[model samples]
Target: MDLQQMRYVVAVAETNSFTRAAERCLVVQSALSHQIARLERELGARLFERTSRRVRLTPAGMAFLPAARQCLDAAERAAAEVAAAVGEVRGRLAVGLIPTVAAADIPGALLGYRRKYPHVRISLRVGASEDLVEQVKQGSLDVAFLGLPPTMRPEGVAAHELARDRLVAVVAPDHPLADEPAVSLRRLSSETFVDFPAGTAGRIQSDLAFSAAGLSRDVAFEVTTADYVTRLVGPGLGVAMLPSAFAPQLTGVVTIEVTDAPTRVEYIIWSRFGHTPAAAAFLKALDIT
Candidate 1:
């Protein structure tokens, strides 16, 4: 019935626990529960099914969540628009990026944005390129930095190219390829490898190149984080191919050029139609059109 009550319900649905939702909403458990109970009574539906160990949304809650989120977004957007009309940028800015992103100094950029727009709320999420792009498209993230193969493009979002670079092979010091000045995919394919999980944007870059060369390699370890990939490679267990710019940042590994290396492109993506004032201002401040 009221925004506050709706917020409590939404928080409970998201967190899946009344106690956690209360903490997120900055209210006591009893008050949040009472408000949501009153709202449920007014609507003639039970929103959540509570158990001793967990909470789950009921059918009615599932149907109500989307509309509740839309209402909250609309209210926030209205206030942001009013502030924009007054030459002020004040709203939430949720940014997402891959952990291996090096196209921009994300931390420094966030620091600058915070300094310039002290009234805005800023949050960051480090995740996979695909997940980050999807988050931006869904409007949960105001902006995202992504890395994908040159042949790929993010669908249903506005993106700007940041930088492009070829990949290099990383090997442990005692590995056979470490002493080599350069190597080919056919050579590296014969050795076991450490790489991102198959089918991910990070792994696909190398896969495409090997496929183009009519070669297949074994990924002995498939890890989500680049640091883990490097850590595995450092033990002489396997080799990896990583962005040329990012390879130098990791130690205990020798970086070697690949004759037919795959190229990766970095991009910054945002919602085409759902740009919050804070997102717009942050982009403008960074000279990203």
Candidate 2:
């Protein structure tokens, strides 16, 4: 019935134990259980199925969970807005970044943000662009820096394009095509390639580029990190197509421009729901608004 009860229910649903939920909410287990029971009675349905080993959410609980989270988020946003009206920026900001993006200016912007709003707590998460975009849409991340192909745009979020870099071909220095000024996709079709795993933005862009060029590569190594791909290329394991910014500076590796390669664009994405004070301040600091 109240926000406190909703918080307790959400906590119990997440932790699956009354004791753990109580610990998370900083309340006594008995009081938390009593509050949840009162809520269930008021709602006329059992929310959680409690057993000796585990607590599972009933259908009612599953249906109510999303709304409860939305209510909590709305409450927080309201508080942040009130603080903002007073020229205050004080709240937690959850930001996500794609690991392969290397915008050197971001660190300086973060430093300026820290100096201007020292009380604002910032948390950073690194992941694939697709994953980070999903987190922003799901309200788990306030904002994110994502690398996506120019043809694609993330849905359900406001995006600001920051920068675009060309995809380049990387190979070992001793390789035949290492000294080339630019390499065509068709020429590398027969060569073994080290690439990012499927479903990532980088891999998706690579696949699209190869398909567009009527070329197919023999991907010999599939790794998660861009650094790993560069390392493998340095050892002559295979050639890789990577964003120019992510190309490594290894002694045995050389990066060549990829002819007709797709441009990887970096975007700053935020939830369509209004920004929190801290998030707004960060956007201002980065001159993104």
Least accurate stretch of 10 residues (summed lDDT) in model 1? 244-253
Model 1 lDDT at residue 260: 89
- Going through the candidates in order, what is the number of backbone clashes in each? 0, 0
Candidate 2 lDDT, tens digit per residue, 125-157? Answer: 988899988899898899999888788998889
Q: Choose the strongest candidate by TM-score.
A: 1
TM match of model 1 to true structure: 0.96
Q: Go through the candidates in order and give each one's C-alpha lDDT.
A: 0.92, 0.86
Number of clashes found in candidate 1: 0
- lDDT tens digits by residue: candidate 1, 214-238: 9989998999998988889998989
Tell me the spans in candidate 1 whose CA falls farther than 4 Å from its real position. Answer: none
TM-score of 2: 0.85
